[model samples]
Target chain A: MTDEAFEQALINLTETMYRVCYAQLRQKADREDAVQEALKKAWEKRRLLRDESALKPWLVRILINECHNIQRKNRRVIPTEDVMPPPPPEDADGVMHDLILALPEKYRMPVLMIFMEGMNGTEVARALRIPPGTVHSRVHKARQILKSQWEEAQKE
Target chain B: MKQFPDDLSRAFGRADKEFVYQVQCTVKKLSEEKRKERTMNKKIPFGVVLFLAILLLAMGTAIALTIHNWKHIETAMDIAVENGAYWEWSLNAKIRLIEAMAEDGLAVSEGDMAALKGDDLTEDEKQELADRILTEQYGEEHFIYYYTIAVAEWGEPQTWTLEQRYWFFKTEREKGLYLDNSWIDLLPEETDLTRDEVVRIAREAVRSAYGMTDEEIESYAPNVSFFITDVCDTPRWMVEFYTQGEDGQIHGSPYSVLLTRDGEVTEDWENLGVLTPAQARLRQERQKETAVDVFTMRGQMRLQDQNTVFWNPEGGKHYHFLADCPMVNADKLPLKELPVWDAQFGLLTPCPCCVSLQDFWSLKDKLRYDVGSWKYPGPDWISEEEAVEKARAALEEEGCSPEGLYPAVYSTGALEEEDRYIVYFDALLTDPDGFTGVDPIYYAIVDACSGEVVSCGESESNG
Candidate 1:
């Protein structure tokens, strides 16, 4: 891709990247740093991206890896905030979204990629680097958990 | 659950606009930073324009005393190197260019060229020998003029390798996650066009296509190389101009064009880098013109299902055949068995990133990713220590001592973009008796997982 196209493509995905970074990282500063680092890597290694069709998942995969590196670095630090950036809302969709975010990261990312990010089983598998079947199983498990949570939210 | 996806998309879409803008800023900043870093020493630009003017200035010895003065061009190039117009390593690149130009003019055999590839002689000795060899073949006066033009052109390191030029096009055509790799090479028929005309056409194409100001051209150090592929009856001039990054790879989008002997650009020029208004209009014209990069909708990209080759569980715009999928097997990411043609596969819109080349022919072939895989195992690659140990053991196994050699460049699996840890070692050479420079002695590519040395090379210290 031309640097113009490459830059524009990355810009267009900023929202998705921000969401992915926010999903994985607790602090905004960490998210900012991770986002920049991932973009830098993607730019430096832009030639490596053989297929442009895979840019979204390919980039998300990079961001997730960056998040992993940050997590690895901050493994010992105690978290001051939970996964949900804000308190749960009253609406069913809002409540359900928070519940998804609250899911264990292994399960949470796949669910978000599939439902929120519109990534499919293979895409989630590629982005998360889990087996395709593994991605299915995790999404399956997360769905069951969300179904139960949705039912309970309806009751409330 | 029915409205869950829509709701989530809506909910997640509420992320801070500042966050999105900040990330955009980050991407822009990073691009600028990389471009700046690459051109850090390139403070003064205008190498090409100045040389072109100089060529015009040197009309003849009768009119201009400096017609014999190749010294001015040589002086200019020396000044460029000193001014950091070229990278430090470009000194090596400069000599390589001169040697290549000289070789082309001399028709040196393959055996001689292979011998010259080895770094057996000092820089000065190599320069002197190159001068002597070319001077003898093409008399002294002609040689000075020839060398002058070479020094001027050498400002932008000309890539002479046929493979390198073709690979530049091939790589651009095959963006890892973009289009299917279907390409047909249709060369414009050979002509009696002179080399000078080819270079001029290519330079103009690059300048116009990128909307590059003279300074931008100089800042980028647009390296243009022309090679007429004579393999077929239609031996056309392939002109490629690209900026070489620190990694010695194309840092910027390379623009190339195939010119008919008459100098008109074929459809080939339109698929490359940021296009100017004129080039964009050409894409508009390609509706009638049979251009190569027209990404026609073929089929849906699918994820693998049990028996169904690809049931379209997810939407992928591009498809790759499962054969030769070494990385996929290793990655455990099953290849989506795609249909020869299927409706289940979601709509294959013009994939945003697939803009370079939308070749659908190689859809049935395994997708090869060079850097990191789509899996992006860069951060999770084997640790540095493990990579070092692997390289160390391989070096010892090869009967090469690791003493005095330091691992200056250590890269793990995903960084290789392949599944190997690339460890390059360099030893500092002391010239108490003669000369000094760091010579890379030994290098190893170790498998990231198995710790096996995939390959290893050792260079005996020639000092």
Candidate 2:
């Protein structure tokens, strides 16, 4: 493919990639960071993806891993600014977004792949290199967390 | 969570665009740095190879001379005796011993081990001595060939066998080691070279050997031609000459030749530098064309067919082409004829680099397919008559009202808004210092389509 065509492919993949990252991390800043990091890695290893047909899958896989890595690192750094009142109701839906970020990485990854990207549970399992049953359970646990968090926020 | 954020998709899209843009910018910067790094890496390997070659050549010449001269051999042997001969020896230890002893004033005859054991030598010395004896018995050629081989293998000097003798003589003559008086030793009669009669005879002998009638060698070489003119006890003939385009004259220096006595070449007959006038002129005519060198304007280029087009990629100006010009890969055609079709056929998809013939054919094949139609347009041929008509129309369209328009105009086969191939030209210019000097005028081709020059001519501007 021509260099211009390859660039167009990158453009097409960017939106889906951003959604996957956002679903996994639940923060606009973190999703953007994850997308940028994933795209950079794909660009650096572009030669390995000479088969342009595989570029989207390749980029999506990388974005998922990068999201997981960022989540793991964020969890290790315990927040010190604490004992404050609940976050303000700015973008009301932003609360669900914040709760998604707080969810365990395992659950968040499957929900992001299944809901945001509309990938099947089996595809999510394959992407994560895990069993389809594990992916189904992760998605189930992610929905439970979101439902519970939404109820708590409503009560508040 | 909290009704699960409906506007998350919109935010995601905006963030995605920003992220892609940032990543693209970073990739562009990294690409430039990586290109520079690759260029530097390419030069390092070539430079290392060149340096190693030069070092080997110098070492070989030094070793060869040391081995050939018995005095150096004696000194080396003394050092070997004082120290251990095979201190740094390995698989070739046996060979080194044979060669060293043969050089150490040892006769090296068969069964001469008993004769060689007069001094209590180290294991290295004993081995070297034994090897020398074996070489003496088995090897021939007065140990000269052995020295040559040793120099070649160890020192790696770059010179053909035919040139070695001349190199040796020239080097020795320059050092004032060889003298003209040595030639008198080859004289049968009692000839006093200093006297008038002997000097006349010596001059006569030189004339006869060089096939010159009465013309002296001095007027030939140093003054006019490639002839050597260095004065020494031993003299050699060197003839040199070249053509002067301004004067339209063929000039040359005289040929220098060693004057031999009784047909025998001695140390004094080492060099007879200079050439006769006739020989100088002959050499001049031969070298005249070769002396013409063209210097190129680095990165500045012009196409042959297009005059107004010029480019300088280094200067950072790109003039978009009116139409893409395809440079034909002339090598693909048979020697009998140039590849006229490709030369005249401009490619629709012109890359920054020259159009490869294989790419042209591949493109042509793909033009009928859906993928090919979307990527590359085809059929870039302009007929001779149609091109002429177009040129006339273009000239008329400009309202120049010229008496005649050249029918040989070309079309850069691109849409009206598409970029055209820059016209590039190769030109020759006289050196600023003038033609009498060593360097010649520069030659170069400028790409006029874009301001960037594609290729440049050879440079001989070093004054």
Candidate 3:
């Protein structure tokens, strides 16, 4: 696809793509920065896309990569105390959001695509360049881990 | 008036909408900018391939420069060296011969295949084998996997007396631990902790769970393969201790250790792969990310909401990213709506013994929680998060808080799900009551997703 055509395709889905970026980055500013960087990268490598329809996944991949880059470079500072705090109440959705955000990169991308973005395991695999079965297993494992943690919180 | 959490959910939705809009605007600007940049790079297809070719050439040159490593071997190996040119030709010929013979459903004997080596196989015979290899072996995941096993040797210098053998094997099925130090560490069987430690942990866990005495534990421990290795670098000790469960099926509990050597443990104590709650919260990130990819070929076969356009491999276009390609919607579906055919996932055929993909995907809560879990293990590698946590705790116990620390989780849960979790932050360690508001933690879940605060607070002003 031509660079202009690719840009146009991405632009058409700009809103949705933005939502995905926002969901990932959390911070509006970071999301904007990530999406912007992703767009530029995608546009510059338009020919690499091969087909116009592949734009979404390609761009999503780029966007996620950009978020990683941003986090890596910024190096957020977390405070550490030796004391053990009381456990928080169970809030499935809230905890899910936090835990999803806490996941490692490999699981996060595939998990996001499968659950939040509402893509199937197959589509997630394609976008991540992983096999469908791996995606399925990862999702299953991710869910299992989440369930275990959730159960842990409830017990506490 | 009782208000529901849905109201907060709406606010979150608004935030999401605004965030999305903000990103779109930035994306538009960046795309325009990249358009200008692309004019310079000039859109080359297989550009990476070209770059890789150049890289390989450089590597080859480097190898060629190092002649001493090629110095020792047998005269037969020397003959192989003298016949380097011939062998190269022969290897190519063999590849062609194999490719051709793949067509037929016949496995030629070594003698016959060797006889055909100097170019004796008819084109038809070659084609048949090639077809057969492609159809039978190449089609199977294991074949492609096993085919990857290879031994490679750099080409010997022309002055060398013996051929320096370099074997390159590629296979689809991998046998060894898929950890980074795989080059240094041998298989699990070869590891130092493979037998004793693994057995100890496994036996301890089993004995505690089953209320077995030391004698019984010792007997079971030797029978089981209990040992731990630096397979994933996590403090993970693979507890392969097993015995006949209540169901009569031989079952094993492979516990992943999240605790430190100094920490006390009881069978009732929770194991989240960490010594403390803070460490667990911090280390869980690594556990999530280092998750191994056991089954190859990840892609969704179902569409979300059934619109299908958002995630169809047969859609307008397909990207190389596995997740971006075709996907089957596994959630929010009726049992009957599940796709009957999936090229990749279809391998998970239903068994009379258990649930099928259809059954699993269609069940209540979108998973067969009632059925037995897949007894397989998790990823073999440790997350950097866990490593960092271990490093930090070592620092803290040693009073190295000034070093400041970062935390990570192993895997991220799927998006859109309501997963609940609680991370413990100790007041004794750092009084939240004394601190300001939420602690500014530089945290992240997955490399793919950003991190958000679960909870951070100072205690209510020392009432």
Candidate 4:
């Protein structure tokens, strides 16, 4: 594709790519690194993109893969810590965001892809390379976990 | 948690202005990297290969045709040499001598030329046969083929074959079969000086005349022959040596030096004047244009002071205005200079300690400030109309008339390092004589912060 077209495509999906990276890699530096790495890979393999229509999904997949690679590398360096509980009521959205992050990795990925990245169940399935039914069940399980934690916090 | 707040978009929009700029820069870098990779991976096109093949075939055919048309005319027979021969003629010189003799009505044919062209006979033998043929037919004047030869062993008849030869004409402009006195060596009947003395004198003359070292003269193995000629009206020693020219071709020029009977060097022939003053100046200018800067492999930078700017050879990114900058290694004495404008164009910051101390402080400060302030536009910046207006004002300040002139303004975006927009203004100056063509007279880069022209220069082209 022409440089202008590739640039325009990146600009159009910048928000989606940013949200995916931010949701997976919480640190600002890590998020930026992931996005840059994904963009570089995409540029190197741009010739493999056959259809312009597939550009968004193709980019999202590369970004998600880059994020996972960074996470795997980070996991080896630091010991696993328990996921933090939801915060207080002054920041309700922040609380919900933390609770969603606290879910299992598989369910957390689908929830973030659906809510933050503005992707539907099938789109999330295509991006994650999983069955659409599996994505639906993961989103359901992720919400259940967040609800149980929210109710328990209310009692405390 | 009936509804997780859908403010994820707001959080996603937190990808700041800096992030966007960084992504753009990364994309630009990646694009350049890919372009380089593609260029490296590209193969020579088939059409270009085909064209080259056809061209070579055509050239080969032309050379073959020329060789086929070469006419064979005359030849001299091989001369026999005794067991102790000192000199012999080159094969090519023998052929040319025979051709010249045939042209002068000597009865030599293609068969004789063929017979002498064989490699079976020794060179001394060939020279004897050539001498006999010339003496019998055209007289001693026709014995024009002559060159100094070195025998491996004295007083021994070893088989010698001539591989390459040269044609010796009577004069540069004359084609007659004549060997000048300069080519022939007449052995001295009674010499006051020995061969070693004559050689020492010749070597000293060569060293003084040509500025060649003793080692270089020894490598040339100069051939010295003593002969008497009326040109100098005295006896002189002729010195000839093969020296490599600037073009990498070997050239041998004879230098004549007259010596008295006591071996005191008298007068030597002066060099023929070659390059005039104007030609020398032109050559110097050409060398300057093509010479590469030692600091940067690019063209030599010409400084504003008319001195070329050189950098430290010991390796530093900063270019120094002075060749002997303290930062430069003393052992690497001779630093290379580059064109000043090229250094500026390359965005190489000058060596602060070297350049700031000199009178070029203002120029250096201006370059550093202007280069640092220049920026590419981000997502939200100044409007194009504002950029154009600033550019127009900048051009007007540069003394361009707004009536006949038109300005082409380009917005290059905001500088990420500073809060300024980079706008380039190109003013098309209409010819005062009402000519059809538009000449770009002024190019200015203005900062959006203060609307001041950071850099301004005359444009080289209309666009």
Candidate 5:
């Protein structure tokens, strides 16, 4: 692809890329590092994209892999004391953000892609390399968890 | 189908401008790599390759000749150096080598090397020369020595296996040449402490110093290593323990102790002071900068209201802001939150160690409480208003404007043992709308009893 075309594609998908990356990695530094690494890898392997339509899913897959690599390396080292969960937000709107983040890793990404990134079920499956049925099931399960947490918070 | 809430969609808009800058930087770097690759693809002509080969060949030949000539001179000196020019040249080379080695902290005396010269030397003379060099260097009675001959092959030095010999020197009776130094045994197995004993001594020292229980000591599993220091003139064990400090950093503190063969501690152990005051201040500054960067990336102006102010109403003595503050016990979960008015009215003092509060209230006329003990005068100290005023004054002295900052005050109540109350306040920078800025939150601590400043500095958070 030409440099101008590549830059345009990147600018159009910046928000989607960031949401996907932030959903996987919590820390700001880790998110930035993962996105930069993913972009470089995508540029290096740009020739492999036979069709321009496949670019978004391919980039998302590379980014998810980079985030996983960072998480794996972090697990091997002794965690510093500052690696605590972000403090809970006090506002009503922020409750959903925290609940989605609190969801288990397996369900969090699919929920984020469908809801936050506005991707369809098939697109999420393609990006994650999973069956479309699996993506639907994960989204359903994540919503159930969020519903229960929301209900419990309301009762309190 | 359920969809993401509007708030959740808006949260995605919180992307930092720094991310875009980082992506552009990466693209620029990749483009530079592509340009370099294109330049490198150009082919080199055969004439250049042939010229480079010829140049390398000439350099190799010169190096080989130099090595060959040096080897011949050294061999002649070993056998018999009757020619005056050759003798003087060999002696000068030997002197230069010894001088260079001495400058590199490996001393070799000229007398020792001179004694080994001359091919007519007897075996006894050679043994005496080796003994003198070893004794001068190691201050030991016995030593193992070896010498090898190097032969030139294709401009490279290869070991001459047939001429290599080893010698062991102790007394005149034990002095003999062999094929290798392996024949000489140097292990002082009986005089050294066992590994298990060293570990036990190190563990005991750590436990006593830190007041740690047996379970806590076992879980930490301090690392112990053995080394021989001349101060002890024997092997001693160095023990290091990794502990979480008040500043939320894992610090390794090492202690060195000398132990006898019988596992008795012969000398008092000394703890290595790792972090100085300047180092602590530097670390705090770095952490504050990192926190500011993170806040800016997240587009957050300040911490949650209830999250920043922590209080234990039942204890009713102190108020804390930072979750990792050292004054609060690690096991104390779910710290209670208090309103700004209640926290200020109760006259609760802030922790000195965590908040870096200056002791504003001196306890000269008031009763003081001794830490870790209940043996002291009653808790009599300054009022809440006085503590707050003193803290504000301290921040003002540090060039903080009250009009542009929101002040959060916390305090530790009067302790009979300490003889004073400690007040701490965080001077958070805010715009006209009461929104916090990216600047560091200044903190000040004061002694409530005498209204004297105890300590003052900046923390990573508003606390």
Candidate 6:
């Protein structure tokens, strides 16, 4: 693909890349690191990308891998004091958002893509390297869990 | 308030405007590279090949004779010495090798890769950049990470974890330590404390935690491995205690305590690492209780309309820094979001298991906590007196008087595989009014361990 076309495609998905990255990494600096790393990786290996249509989901996969890389760093480096200091939940919406964050990674990722960013099963499967069937099943199980909890909050 | 899916999406979908702008800049910057790859796809025409073959055939005999004489090893060496033909070739070859490596993924940053792969940079500029990247910043992060790991793994370094950098340096490069003293630039394991003292500190920490005596601790058979925690970073000891809990009790397996060279426990990791069947079940039961605590806290906040925060309200317990944060429960609520002010965070403590939140503490905080000398550990070999004695002898041999000279030594030559005890002799003159001045007459470079006086001369200040 031409550089201009690649540039336009990536530009169009700026918000999407942001949403997916932010969902996995809460810290702004980490999110920025993940994005920059993913973009650089994508640019260097753009030739390996055989299909133009796969660019968006391809970028998502790169971003997800980078986020996991940042998270895996917890095991190796010495952590510092002070909280990550997530902005406090103002209302039920914020609380629900934290619930999604709280979900185990397998469920949290699909939930963010399918419900949050409106990505369909095919895109998620391609991005996550899972079959479409598995994507829907995980999303279904996650939704059931979220639904029961949301109902409890509504009653409260 | 919105309903289930909408409310959740509302929270997760929102990205701060600055984040969106940052992504824009990054993507735009990456997309502008003039990709110079895809050379293999170009097809060569038979006509061009035939013309080149005919041209070479016409001058083939003369070209072969010229090449055969010059390519000989002895002749090549002579040519290199006479003029500088071989020197230019050697330098150009190294620069080309660097470019090839960078193109193959040694270059961590986007600009390095772009400059090597594009037609934008002149030959001089490319050579200069490659030299700077190769020799400069040897002890900094991201410098040799990809190159070292790629050489070790022979696979893609980009896909590898950041931990691999330290792993390669600590274990894989141990054999190469003597072969090349290049590790000196990256190692500042300078501490006055002996290995025995550091081990004792670790042993005491384990003994106190398990409530065991030294003999009892010996039964567990604790093992220690020294490694760099961060690449181009400080050296740490990963002390692991082998065996499991007694009588099928659940305990931290291969229990580990990370300690600094200055003997400070980085965190309170009384429990961490893998889990056995019994340990998993016990952890589940413990989580059930935490879930209940969080559930009650959440309900109270909902009912009272309180602006709550989420933490282990307990002052001494660890707050998880990982994605699998311990506050989140499988069967129940996530965190019991509390309402503690930033000023009231006196009780919160750092996690011993995952000391991952580096940004939370500033560099000043790290320095204060780490407290390592970060000097070369050459003093461990020979004593200061030995170095001074060698220096005094060298001075005496040179017919120089040592009557008024007091010797001082340092280990600053390790950077060049020359870990020499550089001793300087000083003569001080004290005035009657209590003022004093000092003079240095001679200096000596004594081999740290071998006790050889490598070089001895007058002090630079004396001249």
- Top lDDT model: 6
Task: Please provide, for model 5 over B186-292, each residue's C-alpha lDDT reduced to its tens digit, 9 standing for 90 to 100.
Answer: 11244666556666876786678657688866654344444332122233444444444333333333333444445665544322122232343343333332333
TM-score of each: 0.34, 0.27, 0.29, 0.30, 0.31, 0.33
Query: Which model is ahead, 1 or 3, in terms of DockQ?
Result: 1
User: Which has the higher lDDT value, candidate number 1 or candidate number 5?
Assistant: 1
lDDT of 2 by residue, A15-66 (tens): 6775676567644556665665665565554533334544554567777777
lDDT values of the candidates?
A: 0.50, 0.39, 0.37, 0.48, 0.48, 0.51
Higher-scoring candidate on lDDT, 1 or 4: 1
Q: How many angstroms is the interface RMSD of candidate 3?
A: 14.8
Q: Looking at model 2 chain B, which ten-residue stretch has the lowest summed lDDT?
A: B293-302
Residue-level lDDT tens digits of model 3 in B1-463: 2222212221113234455565566556656644432222222235543653464445544443443322212211322223221112233343443433332323545664564454777754654443344335334211121111111112211111111211110001021212121111111323334434544565665567657688866643223211122222223222323334233333222322222222223332233211333333223322321121101001122211222122232321111211221122334121222232221121121111111111112112122232112111124423334434443444345443523322222222233232211121211112433211122232222221122233333212211
Ranking by TM-score: 1, 6, 5, 4, 3, 2
Worst 10 residues of 1 chain B by lDDT: B290-299
For candidate 2, write residues B382-413 as lDDT tens digits. Answer: 33334333433443444433232111111232
Task: Name the TM-score of chain A in model 3.
Answer: 0.67
Which segments of candidate 6 are over 4 A away from where they belong?
Answer: A50-52, A75-85, A88-92, B1-3, B6-8, B33-463
Report lDDT (Cα) of residue A133, candidate 5.
Answer: 83
lDDT of 6 by residue, B1-463 (tens): 4466553556654566777787788766554424321112233355544653564345444443432211222222222233221112343443444554444445446687578557899875775565466545332212223233243333232222223323333322332321222221112133535555655777788788857688866655344544331112344554555433333222223235667656687662222222333443344333322232111222222223324334444432433333233223333334345443332222233232222222222222223333111125343557767778887898789887676555544544223455556666655434554212344566777777888887777764411
DockQ of all models, two decimals each: 0.11, 0.05, 0.07, 0.06, 0.08, 0.13
* Candidate 1 interface RMSD after superposing interface residues: 16.9
| lDDT, residue B285, model 5 | 30
Model 1, B337-449: lDDT tens per residue? 64533423222222211222212112111123121112232455666567777888888888888775656333332322455555656554445542123456677876666
lDDT of 4 at B242: 40
lDDT of 1 by residue, A21-59 (tens): 767876665677678767766776564332455578778
Over A52-95, each residue of candidate 5 has an lDDT whose tens digit, in order, gives 45567667877898888656433211111343555533332566
